[model samples]
Target: MGGGNTAEQAREVLMDAAEHLFVTRGYRASTMEVIAREAGYSRTAIYRQFANRDELVAAMVQRTTQRHMVSILSRIPAGAGPVDLLVESLVIVASELVSDPLLNTIADQTADGTIASLIANDSGLTELVKSTVETVVADGTPFRPGLHPNDLAQFIIATALSFLMKTVPAVTDPAVARSYIETFILPAILQESPEPRRVF
Candidate 1:
């Protein structure tokens, strides 16, 4: 194999090993020595690729978030009604946060202040969701008065994260969480009320 390919492979190996250790062992308890041993490399080799454990964890979080954005975008049904599409997008994000191993690890590690700061500084996910909403609004979808599409999109993302935090542990069934989002959030975003049907 080429030297560059070998180096790339080693980096992937280190990241995979670090992700597993960081998730299973907790970031504070998982030392570089342990990660090196897990990755089948010496401490020096690990340091060559990553300056420290924090950098390694940040890389893992970036990779995880990118994968998450792809997953959410893929699940958005084509030609869906605006409200339904928005709800599905929010649910996809919440589901990922609830189920994804890397995100779970980041949530765990966030207790130490590193992961929270990383997330607060990172707006990639927010921007992606905002762009999607802008597309819908540009396509002439209706939204409630006083709520700009971009602002509503940000609110949806924030609400999804909040719902994931509150309900993930207690609600094992996804339907329950979806119901809450649809019932509570959909009405707020709707632009029109249903017309009353006349009795025949």
Candidate 2:
């Protein structure tokens, strides 16, 4: 319908303006009026799309993180081993934080940087991680007993996101990053290690 299309388009335009301003000016400095002016629209238009600047910024961050995740994960091969796939998934996340244009821009501009919290908090991403776990372990593999699939997924996603925010040199090398992640995060749910558990 003409109504929805025009509204959706206007929303996208406003979001684009907000994203640029946020990247160039940081979250605190970017204002609703400034975003509307940059979008060449009235403040009324933004309010139609979003209740406030916080809502608009949250939406933009969610969209941007989703886009980045989809792009990075799409590159992994389908036939790879489950552990390999999971490790690579996290490695790609780390690599993107340091390299992806939008993420790099956000890191440079914000004081409390990282869109990871936004992504990790979103139900969509949680669902995505669960779905990925289901899909990857579909080949007769089982997660360790006492660990819910969703809980395992949440642990992996949270650890991966936290690691992504760090600037460690090990994460700079995709191969090394993958190895560390495999040894660190995957062992918990995978329970592949024979070593005795130390701490909870």
Worst 10 residues of 2 by lDDT: 191-200
Candidate 2 residue lDDT tens string, 34-139: 8888888877777878897546756775676677668767787877777667767788776666564445443433334445555566566677678767776654
The C-alpha lDDT values of all candidates are 0.65, 0.67
- How far off is residue 84 in model 2, in Å? 2.1
lDDT of 2 at 62: 60
* lDDT per residue as tens, model 1, 1-200: 11343766777888888888877887777788888888888898888888877677766766776677677667777778767776676666655466766665545554457464554444665565677677767535667666676577567655755644554443324565566665566667776634333211
What is the alpha-carbon lDDT for the whole of candidate 2?
Answer: 0.67
Off by over 4 Å in 2: 1-5, 104-116, 137-139, 167-169, 193-200
Q: Give me the candidate number with maximum lDDT.
A: 2
lDDT of 2 at 67: 79
Worst 10 residues of 1 by lDDT: 191-200
